[model samples]
Target: MKNVIKTIGIWLYILGCLVVGSVFAQDVHFTQYTATPVYVNPAMSGFHGSNYRAGANFRTQWNAVSTGNTYRTFNMFADFALGKPTYYSNYAGIGINFYSDQAGDLNYSTNKVDLNVAYHFILDNKGTNSISAGIQSGFGMRSIDLTNAVFANQGGGFDPLGGETINRERYAMFDVGMGFLWSYSPNKDRSYYLGTAMHHLNQPELSQFTSIGVSDRMYAKFSVIGGMQVPVGERMHLQPSFIVNRQGPSTEINLSTLVSYSFNREPFDKNSIAFGMMYRGPLDAIALLTRVNLETLAIGFSYDVNISSLSSASRSNGGPEISLVYVGKPKNRGSERYCIPF
Candidate 1:
């Protein structure tokens, strides 16, 4: 049987979290970026036309080599928009998000709470064009459970405490991020947006050893996330989206296309179903996504197919993720609904 690789991988995962070894890691990510708009870019804090919105995302990955060891992530967020839909009216957006990420076996976890604020510059009364700027302040904490950790020299023992150390195992930090987004729509039916964000501006030092310069600080991240919506037919529409992330020495890119079939066209809320394929690279994986929308609520699901070098052990199976979004609409405000996410 093969046991060597799994052991090495677990150690690498631990080192990745500590950022003191050759390994380093990035922030948690989900395949359904559409469902986690505010988490992706603070500029999207109040991009939706609704008065308020809320959503959650969950993901579990990498159970191939070891069944008990995997990576899990969860995020929940909500945002509010207050303003009029007029060419001359300006608006302010506010949002809050909380997320937790944990790696199995090591029982390592990171949790963060974030506050997001944005200002939108309405270019026209029709809400055809607008630009937004946003800023984020957050608090983060990380820790590890050595009891579940399989360290060397234990001969794979089942000790309760596993090992002993004097270094601090948990710490917390304050984080800062900001971004800008621009949305443009020639008419009410077609729309697109492009945004860029910078995260980890303070470079939080994530070292379990409690040593400062010895370990590399969390790397600053510059990200580009955008999408477009186009109408190809009366009921069918083409939606393409992408997100590219660069943090420290790592890079991730995901591109997706989903076709939507509308069943009901409500001026304020639309009912539809969408399905599509996504390609994630730098040589990673492909995913299948499906989304359903009913009035003010939408649900999305995605399954990834492992295509990277680790596919052999993963058996080409990546992981599964689910996302939910809800928007609150109060009657009809005396304004035009212009923000459309295709």
Candidate 2:
């Protein structure tokens, strides 16, 4: 009886997602928006403290809702800057991003790959302020497995598999996005930035079925992201960030604050510990985040505590995410005058 109840609840959750998808046509997202910089803004392609950057992220959600019925996502990116290393010189950036998401009992999945480019404009002689514009192009594929789907008319009762034909299992589409950003860094201990991005500008078709009356077009999404870094002391700093996203009829907002303490006085030494909290509004969840930095490598972890109406179904279990990042210069290269840790 417990198993049957869990199965029914899982189906209900899946049904809800499908209904919402059909109406709002929203996209999958990460709570840790800053961890996936390129996904948030193409202008962030190579906007780190180092000349090159690489990172990976993974998230899993709703494990307590039902066994074997959950959502998982994985993402990876790499980016680098072009031209000579000088604070007063302009440069270009290029990057690649890839991600995959799997959801529900049907094992529905989406895979995407994107290429991004950006140009940076130096706004001051000291290079303390700059602007950037970026563009991205991508392709994505969506698929679902229907072999285990249950139908109402199968065997004249509730059947796990029916005789109905499932003609389409996958679909592919192309997508594009653009962004603009402005950054200011007075010194190594303080920085601020704001950016906006628009995605799915083409609204490409997403339906696998070629039949009439099917209008499964991807909806356009817009985002606003901003953050600042403040030095609390010689070995401590504070960071506050926010992100707002809107797609079709749905919207989400996250606000966060973090504090980091460095073990060494040198800003570039990179030995530090950071911890923070975030709130997702409309009462979604409260997230706790922590990270450790070791020279050129950093590792981060976060967990969400659900606090919304869905907590009844989710059992307040929410989700957990992990991320790894690396930033470095070439073997013969030295550090630059301007650095942005994010």
Candidate 3:
């Protein structure tokens, strides 16, 4: 019975791949997508409450299923409020980010660096409401180590050379994306925001094999993200956020909520804690997460519980992720007029 179940799980996975046919690499993804905002939307680049913010995230997935086939991702970013805004003045922000992802027996990897810029237009006095437009320009490299790849001809053994003529071992390309965001903040706190982005607008070619007559271009992706913080009590807030992404034949959606309690009474209290649950697309997994906001520092952790048919082989454990962020505070910077959040 156990073997039958395992075989069914494998078939389900193969069927999924067939149904999604050549969905191309949307693999640079995270269950805790909120932890790396800049990587998702350029408009979030410099949209924060403080003068500047920096953060990093790391993720490892599917370790229980295989010792050498787990997927790993790491990314870091820095965003800066370019100029000080007045009660109703428009301003701009800039940011840069780096991302790396790799997985499988072949050690296939994707790495990218991007520069983002955004211009904000204040919609009301006190910078309480605003809209912004942003652009991202980046360079990307996709590579793979074929040393451990086993082809059907190899009969399930490693082959340093698969008797195939490879066109290129790795390649680099230029990539572009754009985004827009709307924000509403009634008081001195995190703003409610809605944003949309279009990535891989240029559809950079990333194929590493010469099997096809033509190389493959990465599928463009569209994303919608929204978030808000609602005060539920004197010292606690309800933080709810969501993201939707579509690339070629693949689509993913995540909805999450966290309850945050401030240990300090300061307006921008850095001492706080938040815990919550999140759900992934079409019953992929359920995640539990917690975040700690300390003085000038924040850390977050999340665990994913898989529920798909693949869970049989994975023991329902999707994996774990962690994030670290430095939330900067400006001293005597003359009343910050811009928003903060990216």
Candidate 4:
């Protein structure tokens, strides 16, 4: 049964890779729930008003299994709101994110750095509704170190000895995305936000492996993101969100819901703490969530309970992730108003 399960899992992973599916479909960590920070839509950059936002996340996955199968990830991003309230008519932000992943004897490791710029233009601001068109430009490089990776030894590395020096390859790609956000309810207790983003407009070429004669292809991904908050009482609220990602031949869907109970009425100094839980589909896992807000600084943590086939081998450690965010409030008048358009 163990071997069968392993085989099935391997096949599923292969199918997921070969089918030209959504790149964002691969689940990595929990902080992705913050939604806005991940650039799920380019238009989200400065949608939250004139505030500087910074965040980071760390995820450790599959620790229950062998050490090699466990995955670790680290991410950081920051964004600034464009324009001043009294002199500006548009909103925009510039953001940069760095990510690194390690798995399977370090054979499957990925390092990426991305710089993105987003802009939002006010379309209409009716009583309580604000609509804007968001656009973003993404620049990044992805690299892999295959020296000690398990996959490199699968076929025979050098010849008879099955040992070959690990080779590293890196590639750079450009991505363009656009998003639309419709926000309603303003400063009310109950609010709703709707957002949609389409990414990888350039169909980034991820073909570092193709240099050895393997066929490689590039695909575009379109994502839809939206969230609604329903207050149960003065102290508690339920928030549900849906994410849809589609590639050329495959589609991945994620649906999650969380509840946050506040103790201090959303903190006046931008600093507070909240505890919550999340249900993520596709992988069918439950995670514990906690967040800290210190004025312009925010941090989040998530630990997953593996419930899928991987759980049997996971030994219950599943995956753990941590994320951090920093929003920079402008002290001067110059740095606060100059936002490069996406």
Candidate 2, residue 231: Cα displacement in angstroms equals 0.9
Residue 281 error for model 1, in Å?
Answer: 0.6
lDDT of each: 0.79, 0.79, 0.77, 0.57
Structural similarity to truth (TM-score) of each candidate: 0.89, 0.89, 0.88, 0.75
Top-TM-score candidate index: 2
Model 3: residues >4 Å from true position, as ranges? 1-24, 155-164, 210-212, 266-269, 331-333, 337-342
Q: Per-residue alpha-carbon lDDT of model 3 for 184-266, expressed as tens digits?
A: 88774556889999998998876544453435667899999998876788888888899999997788889999888888843
Residue-level lDDT tens digits of model 2 in 155-255: 33444421222234677879999999999999978888999999999998765443423356788999999998888998888989999988877788999
lDDT of 1 by residue, 224-334 (tens): 988888888877778899999998788999999998888865322369888999999987999999998888889899999989999998898889999999987643664
Question: Cα lDDT for residue 275, model 2?
Answer: 91
Q: What is the lDDT of residue 157 in candidate 2?
A: 49
Candidate 4 segments exceeding 4 Å error:
1-31, 35-38, 86-88, 123-128, 149-168, 209-213, 248-250, 267-272, 329-342
**Clashing pairs for predicted structure model 3, backbone only:** 47-341, 48-339, 48-340, 48-341, 49-340
The better candidate by lDDT, 1 or 4, is: 1
Error of 2 at 14 (Å): 13
- Candidates 1 and 4 compared by TM-score, better number: 1
Superposition error at 186 for model 3 (Å): 0.4
Query: Between prediction 3 and prediction 4, which has the larger TM-score?
Result: 3
Q: What is the C-alpha RMSD of each candidate to the true structure, in Å?
A: 4.5, 4.9, 5.8, 6.8
